[model samples]
Target: MLIKMNNIHKSFGTNSVLKGVNIEIQDGEVHALMGENGAGKSTLMNILTGLHKRNDGTILIDGKETYFKDPKEAEKYGITFIHQELNIWPEMTVLENLFIGKEITSSFGILNTRKMKALAREQFDKLSVNIPLDQEAGRCSVGQQQMIEIAKALMTDAKVIIMDEPTAALTEREIQKLFLVIDSLKKQGVSIVYISHRMEEIFEICDRITVMRDGITVDTKNIPETNFDDVVKKMVGRALTDRFPARNPNPRETVLKVRNLTQKGVFHDVNFSVKSGEIVGVSGLMGAGRTEIMRTLFGMDSIDSGDIFINGEKRTIKNPHEAIKLGIGFITEDRKDEGLILDFSLRQNIALPSLKSFSPKGYMNRKDEQDFVDMLIKRLTIKTQSSETNAKDLSGGNQQKVVIAKWIGISPKVLILDEPTRGVDVGAKREIYQLMNELTDRGVAIIMVSSELPEILGMSDRILVVHEGTISGELPKNEATQEKIMTLATGGQ
Candidate 1:
C-alpha cells in the first residue's frame, strides 16, 4: 500500500466529525472518497493534508508511520493538495502563480524568472494545457484556472494528489480533459484521492470507492463489486427511492413572460413563459447562455431589448431589489461569490431578504428576526449549532439551504434557481427536490438552470434547450430525452 489511514478521529468542539475512518490506497489507483455533504470527507482529507489535526489516528506511508504538521510539510512528503477553490493569486501571472512560494533563486539572490517560466511551460505541455504563461491568472477562464491549479500541484513532484470537487466549475469538455490527465498520472504510478459528488464520474474514473456518512467509515468496495444504488445507500445510510418527486402535471396560468429579451453579444431573441405550479428547466451546454438568461431576467444584467410581463402586466425591473419587490427571486449560480453572506450568522442570512417585513416603522425587531430564522432553519433542516452560528461554518449543502431559506422568506411568485444542487451531495439533492415540491405545491413558478441532464429530465415539467445564446427547442416532460436535449443543446436546430 502507498498510503494507509487507520482509526482516524476528528472533532470540532462537541461535534464529532470523523470517527474511526480507515482507508488504504495502492500506488496507482484513482480512489474515490464519497459521502454526503457534512459527512466528513473534507475533514479526513484535511487531516491528511495537515489542514486539521486528527485527535487520534495513524497514517502510514510506504509501510512507515508518518505525520504532516502543516501543509508545507505535507507537500515536502510528496503529497500535494489541489483545493476546489484554487489557491493561486488572481493578480499574479500564470508562471508566478505556479512557482509561488517555491520560486527559484539564483546564487546572487536574484529571482530566476527564466528558469521558473521554463519549468512551468514544461509542466503545462505535459498536461496539454493551452494558455499563455504570461497571462494574468484572474483573466483565465474557470477551466484554465483549474488546469493551472493541477499544474501547480505537479510542480511539487506530487506522488499523491487530493482533488476536491474538481469538476464543480468545469464545462463538459474540460471535465473530459481532466479525466485524461488523471489517466496519465495513474499510468505514471501517481495515486489520486478524488473527492466529488457526481455519480457518473465516480463510476467512470474510480477503481475503488470509500463511502462515509455522519463522520464514520461506511464501506469500501472495488468498482466491480458495487453499483450506484449500493454506493448511494452507503453514502446516505438509506436507500434513495427516487431521483425526483411527482410534480404537477397541469400547470396553472403563466406567471412570468419574457418577450424578445436581448443582451447584446450574449443572448438574443429569447421568449419564454414560466407557469405557476410548474418547473421550467433551462438546459444547455456550458457557455450556451443559460445562466446569462436568468441573470438578465432577474435584473442582474441590463437587457438591451426585452419586455417582462408579470401577471399579464409589463414591468421594467432596473435592479434585483426591484425584481424582489415585484415578487421575483433569484438564487445565483456561484454560491461562494454571490450567495449568502459568509461572515454573518444563520439568523442574519435568512432574514436578509425579508428584513423589512420582520421589522416595522423603521425599527428592527430582534425577536421576530431570530424566530423567523429559527423557523426556517428547522423547516429547511439546516444542520447548525444554532441560529447564531456563522454561515461559513456550515457545509456546502447547508450553506445552499441558507440561500434557499433567505429567498423563501420573501415568498416570491417566480423563483429562478441556477445550478441549485451544483456541489451538493445526493442526500442534500433529495432534500432540495422535496423543498421544490413544497414550493410548487404552493403555486410558485420555478425556473431551474442545470447542466445535469438527468436532473432536468427527472425534475422538469418542461425543458428549454438553449444553444449559443438562443432557445433552440422546448419539450414537454414526456417527450424530452437525453439524446434530444443534447441535439438541441449542440445547435441541431
Candidate 2:
C-alpha cells in the first residue's frame, strides 16, 4: 500500500466530524472517496493532509508510521492536495502561478525563469495541455486552470495526489482530456484519491471505491464487484430505484417564446420555446451562450434583435423587476453568491422576493411572514435548526433547498434553473429532481441549463444543444444520447 489511515477521529466544538474512519490506497491506482457533502469526507482528508488536527488516528506511508504536522510536511512526504476551488493568483502568469511559493533561484538569489518555464512546459505537455505559459492564469477557462493545477502538483514530483471535484466545471471533452492525464499519471505509478458527486466518472476512472457515511467507512468495493445502484444505496442508506422522477408525459400550451433572439457577440439566431408542464434543457459546453441566453430571457442582459412572448403577450422586460412582475424567476448557477443572502436567516431570504405581500399598505405583517416561512420549510424539507437560523449554517443540500423554497413561494409562470444540481449530493439531487417534477405538474414552464449529459437526458422533455453562440440541434429525450449530444455540441451535423 502507498498510504493508509486507521481509526481516524476528529471533532469541532461539540460536533464530531469523523468517527474512526479508515482508508487505504495502493500504488498506481485511482481510489475514489465517496460520501455526501457533510459525511466527513473533507474532514478525514483534511486530517490526512495536516490541515486539521485529528483527535486520534494512525497514518502509515510506505509501511512506516508517520505524522504530518502541516501541509509542507505532507508535501515533503510526497503527498499533494488539489482543492476543489482552484487556488491560483488571477494576476500572475501560468508559469509564475505554478512556482508561487517555491521559485527556482540562482546562487545570487535571482529568479531562474528559463529553467522554471522549461520545466513547466514539460509538465503541461505531458498532460497534453497547450495553453501559453506567459498568459494570465485566470484568463484561461476553468478546465485549463484545473489542468494547470495538476501540472503544478506534478511540478512538485508528488507520488500521491488528492483531487477534489476536479471535473466540477469541465465540459465533456475537457473531462476526457483529464482522464487521459490521470491515465498517464497512473502509468508513472502515482496514486490518486478522486472525490466527486458525478457517479459515471467514478465508475469509469476509479479502480476501487470506499464509501463513507456520517463518520465511518461503510464499505469498499472494486469497480467490477459493485454497481451504481448499490453504491448509492450504501452512501445514502436508501435505495433510489430511479435517479430522476417521472417526466411530464404531456405538455400543454407554450408559455414562453423567443423569436430569433440575438445578442450580437453573445448569441445569435437563438430561438426556442417552452410550454407549460415541460422541461426544456439547454445542453452545451461552457461558453456556448447558454447562460447568456438565459440571462437575456430573464432580463439581466439586453437582446439586440428579438421578441419575447409570455402567455401570448409580447412584452419588453427591461430588468429583473419587470421579469418578476411578469411572473418569471431565475435560480442562478452559483446559489451561494447569487440565490441566497448568506448572512441572513432562512425566513428573511425566503421572504425577500415577495416581502411586499407581507408588508401590505406600508406596514410589515410579522405573522404572515412567519406563517409563509414555516409552510415553506416543512413543504420543501429544508433541514435547519429553525427558520431563524442563518443561511450559511446549512449544508450545501439544505442551502440549495432554501434557494428553491424561496422561488417556490413566488410561484412564477416561468422558472429558469441554471445548473440546478451543481455541488449537491445525490440525495439532494434526487430531492431537487422531485421538486422540478412537482413544479412542472403545477403548470410551471422550466428552462434548465446543465453540463451533465445524464442530467439533461434524464429530466428534460426536449434538449437544445448549443455550439459557439448558436443552437446546433434539438433532441427529444428518447433520441438524446451522450455521444449524440457531444457530437452536436462540437458542431457536428
Candidate 3:
C-alpha cells in the first residue's frame, strides 16, 4: 500500500492547524512523522484516516484518489490508527475491548465467544502480550494497556498502520518486542506511519522521515541521509544545543522524607528523601510501583503504614487538598484526566490551585488571576492563540506545560513530577529541563519519576532505581550509567 497526501489544509474555525502539508508513504516501509507537539503531524494523519476531513487537499491511495467517510470506513479499507491517547473502555474486559465494534457472531446473531477468544489469543501471541482476557482493562498497567492497543491494531491486519506515540508507556523490553514486530510487519509488506517524538527510536526503526513545523512539511529525507540534529532543527525551526540544561545543585536541609512507606500489596518499605534544591529521579520498569509511591505521597492513595516528614516535622497527608496545603505539588502522569480539565480554559486551569490566594476577602480577584495566567504563559513559552483557549486545544507538550504551571502557581516547597516529559518533543523537553533547573535554583525539592534512562542520567542529581515494590539501588549523578540503572531496575545487585 502507498499513500500520498498533497497540499493538505485543516482549520477549526479561525485556527489553522495544517497548512499545505505533503507526505508520501511507501509500501512495506516505516515512515517517521517528526514534529514538535501541535506541529500538525497528527492532524495530517487524522485527515488520512478520515477522523478529520481535509478542508483542502488530495489523498491518493495506490495511485487512486480516496477519501474515507469515517474511521470505520477507513478500517474497512485496511487503514488503522492507534492513537496516542489509549481509548480503552476501562470497565470492559480485555477480550471485549479487543472486539468491541467488530465482534464475531453466529448465523443466529449469537455472540461467538470461543471464536473471539481464539482470534484475540492469536493477536496477543503475536505481540507477546500476556494480559488476561477476562481481566478489566483498567486493572492492567499503562504498559499493558499500550500492548492491548497494539494488539487491537494488529488484529485488523491493516495495510497501513498509524502509530502515534505507541511506545510512550512501554518499557525497554516491550519496546524491543514492538520493534521486532515492526520489522516483521515490514517484511510482510505492511506500511507503518510511525509518529513519535523520540529521536532515537525513529532513527533506529524508520526507513524515511518527514519533518513538520508550524502546520507545513519542512522536509523529507531517507533515514540514512538525515542526522538527529538535522531532523530536530527542521521540527523546531531552531537549534537545540543541549537536550538537558545544566543544574548547579545547592543541597539544603531535607524538605520531604519517607520512611517505611507501605502501600501493602502495591509497594513496601520505600525509604527516600529529597533535599531542598535537588532532583531525585526514580527509575523503574512500568508497573514497578513508581507511580504508586508518588500517588501515596500526594495523598491520592493511602499507605498501609508510613511516616512522611516535611522539614523535620512529621506530617499526615490524608488527601490532595491537605497535600497542597502542606506546600507539596503533584504533577500526575496522566495529564488528560488528572492534570487538567480539558474543557477548562488555560486561565481556569492555571488558576485552579491558586484560586484561594486570589480570592482575598472572599471575593474573586479577576485582575490578579489574569496577570498570573499571563506570566505563566510567557514563562513556560506556551503556544496558544490566547489564554481563553480551551485546554484541549493546546498540543500535548503545551498541555504538560499548563500542568506544570498549575503546580508552580502555588510556589511549592516540594514538587512530585511523574513522567514530566513523556510525550513532549525535544525543544519542549529542553524548556522543561531548564524550568526544572530554575525551580531547583529557587530551593524547591523535586522528585521526578521517569522511564527514560537518558533523561534520568542527564537531569537528576541522584538516581533511585525501583525494582518490584522497593528501592533497589541509588546512584549519584557522576557515577550512574544506563547499564547500571537497567540492572538495578531488574532487581540486580
Who wins the lDDT comparison?
3
* Ten-residue stretch with the least lDDT total in model 3: 238-247
Candidates in descending lDDT order? 3, 1, 2
lDDT of 2: 0.86
TM-score, predicted candidate 1 vs. hidden true structure? 0.91
lDDT of 3: 0.92
Name the candidate that leads on TM-score: 3
- Candidate 1 lDDT over 1-493, as tens digits, reads 3999999999999988898999888899999999988889888988988999999989999989888899999998888888765576779998888888898999998999888888988888776777798999876655578788988997887899999888776656567878998998999999999998899999999999999988889999999899989999889878999867677655899999999999998999999999999999998876678888888878888999989999999999889999999999999866666787889998888998899996688999888888888889888788888888888888877888899899989999999998888778987888888989889989999999887788899999999999999999999999999899988988895
- TM accuracy, model 3: 0.98
**In candidate 3, what are the lDDT values of residues 1-493, reduced to their tens digit?**
9899999999988999998999999999999998999898888988998899999989999999999989999999999999887889999999999999999999999999999999999888877788889999988877788899999999997999999989988878778889999999999999999999889999999999999999999999999999988998899888889777788999899999999999889999999999999999999888789999999888999999989999999999999999999999999988887899999999999999999999989999999999999999999989899999999988878899999999999999999999898788999889899999999999999999987888889999999999999999999999999999999988898
Candidate 2 per-residue lDDT over residues 1-493, each given as its tens digit = 3788999998776777789998999999999998876787767877888988989989888889887889889987888998765677888999888999989999999999999989998887777778899999867755578788878887888888898877776678778878988898899999999988899999999999999998899998898999999999999999988888777546999999988999998899988899999999999987788888988888988999989999888989889989988889998766655689999999999989899888778999999999999999998777666798899866665777888888888889999998787767787788889989989999999999988988999999999999999999999889989999999999998
C-alpha lDDT of residue 456 in model 3: 89
Ranking by TM-score: 3, 1, 2
Query: Candidate 3: which pairs clash?
Result: none
Clashing pairs in 2: none
Residue 448, model 2: Cα distance from true site in angstroms:
1.3
